[model samples]
Target: MGNLDGKVALVTGAGGMRGVGRATALKLAAQGADLAITDVRRDASDLPPAEVRQEWHSIDSVSDEVEALGRRCLPRYADLGISDEIQTLVRQVMEHYGRIDILINNARAVIGRDKVPVTDLEEEVWHHFLDINTTAVFLCTKFVGQEMVRQGSGGRIINIASNASKQASAMGAAYSASKFAVLGLTQASALDLAPHGITVNAVCPGPINTDRMSYWERSQADAAGVSLEEFRAQIVEQAGRATPLGRIAEAEDVANMVGFLVSDEANFITGQAYNVNGGLLFH
Candidate 1:
């Protein structure tokens, strides 16, 4: 029998093909947990020219995979950054699954325009990043924690932070600040929820090979006047060389960490930010 047999998990931002959310959902499902997977489900106009919209089938595809694993799946579309939408999402999950045993707050905001230097950053850009990255984490944890408490059975809440949470980035002030706040939320929530037997933690992933990273690479390459292929090659080489493990990470790598964090083996661990960055940063 699977470790998460008969449990229900709710994962956000699970639509992207190579994203941590998708990988985590599948991993959890394989462990026998029914899943409620959500995504924004529309192409952002701000995406790079080479970044095509995720086909509407993204969440459906994840659901199909979950079902194939013999676990129930509920696919929903919601913008987690919006308070009302998050409330509606929790309600839908509860109605569909009757309980929420795990919550992976994996949805995040990373606009290309926000990648500029601090001097050129706009007020709206900072707020936009915080709204989705930090604020949404709070809202989801607050609402979902309530449900977990009501059930009176301890649950796990894992926030998808980033390696940027530990240090500042040269031109990534907004993103970095928002992720730093995520770590704070994770720790503080872990304390408050401990009395109720709930555990809160954050997973800080390094540069995983995802569509979002590809878009960022394309933008950086254009700025450097290099072809996308050349930029990608240079970046892979640099990151691989810098990392102690001699390679960058894949989405499944981060998912593996999440899988362990939510399992019974990690029941004693809480209020921690686990880094899954191939030994890039020692903490």
Candidate 2:
């Protein structure tokens, strides 16, 4: 038997091949939690060139993996940027599972456009990041948190933040700002829900190995007039040399942190942003 044998978890952005969401879903399932996973069903227009598109069925594929671990899995498609969609998604999860004990807010929005300085950033782009990254967190926490409160059994809510939350980037003002807001949300929600046994926390990961990271690398490489291969090499060397731990992190590293946070062992922890960035930023 596992620590979460009877728990039900809802994870967002879980359809990527090498994502923190997929890893976290698997970790929670391995600990015996049934999963309700969501992903935006991407079409050709939503993606880049054929070569850039990841060839995997996001929700169905991950659901298969979760079920293989002997845990119930529900795969759903959701845009998540829309309030109505979020409400409906939460309602469906509660209806299917009876209760929600864990929520992992791991979905993010990234545009492949070149990274530009703050002054050159488009207004639409800024709102886009905030809408998907920051606002979605608020809406999900609001609705799902209400459900947890009504259930009266307490719960765990983990927001997937980034190293950007703590540090500013030269050409990443919008993205950094959104993540910083996520930290704020996590802390505030934690304080609000702590009295009822719920713990809210955020995890900040630095340069994890994921397909989304790869997409960013490609965009940055193009912006810097370097080939993708050269950019990849430079990033690996830079992260390895700069980080105190001598290497960047894998998706599993972040997932391990999420797993612990949702477990009973972390009952005393709340309202804190845990950094899993291999000592890149000390707070």
Candidate 3:
């Protein structure tokens, strides 16, 4: 009896236990949508300590949670950066579910060696990030949008952008550039898909409480020669004070926004990017 009772949603990068992708999948599933979730095959040892402790088997565990909520789930492994893999993913979903009612483009390049001054960044790393962040988004949206158009009933496509979309990151030139392009793609795709009744929007989140943020924070802590514990506390305090809401955000906070955007409630909203930054940045 949920709003998306017969709908199917494809969420990429859903393997992270505390990531927005997993939360969004559960949110959409709770609202009655069958899920097709994908992520790169991962090793348990490489996961965050929390995930390892809890024995979270990435996408498999996520699928278990979705089915527990009484919604169907199709879990697959696809390196989003590979164009052929993405096409195969779409075809697999079509062959399995026969229709895709929503697409959550939540996968992106992981922040890493590229988190340095532009002058210090490697050309190879730059293209790698763009391939995963920008190119992958393009491929997913293109293929999925085609399916939605063919369906003729419209659909929802949500891109997990970043606050970096509007503001440049100090040591994140490649990351920021990718996100900026995502916003542009979102707007352009929104226009192209509008006539087809499909709504495309971007969710630009700020510092969130997730493993990805933890890794970034650790990098800073190491650079400053400070203890991870001390640096973590200090940054959280500073970020909380800077934000209007007086706190950082949880993964579910962004997921809640995604749930709303995909629902009928946001039917009239499209071609726009919403900053789910706890009021840290206002436009």
Highest-scoring model, TM-score: 3
TM-score of each: 0.92, 0.92, 0.93
Residue 87, model 3: lDDT of: 97
Q: Model 1 scores what on Cα lDDT?
A: 0.87
| Tens-digit per-residue lDDT, 69-123, candidate 1 | 9999999999877899999999999998899999999988855667788999999
Q: Which candidate model has the greater lDDT, 1 or 2?
A: 2
- Give the TM-score comparing model 1 with the true structure, all chains together: 0.92
The RMSD of every model to the true structure, in order and in angstroms, is 2.4, 2.4, 2.1
Query: What's the ranking of the predictions by lDDT, best on top?
Result: 3, 2, 1
Residue pairs with backbone atoms closer than 3 Å in model 3 (clashes): none
Candidate 2 regions with alpha-carbon error over 4 angstroms: 45-54, 213-216, 219-230
* Candidate 3 structure quality by residue, lDDT tens digits, 65-94: 999999999999999888999999999999
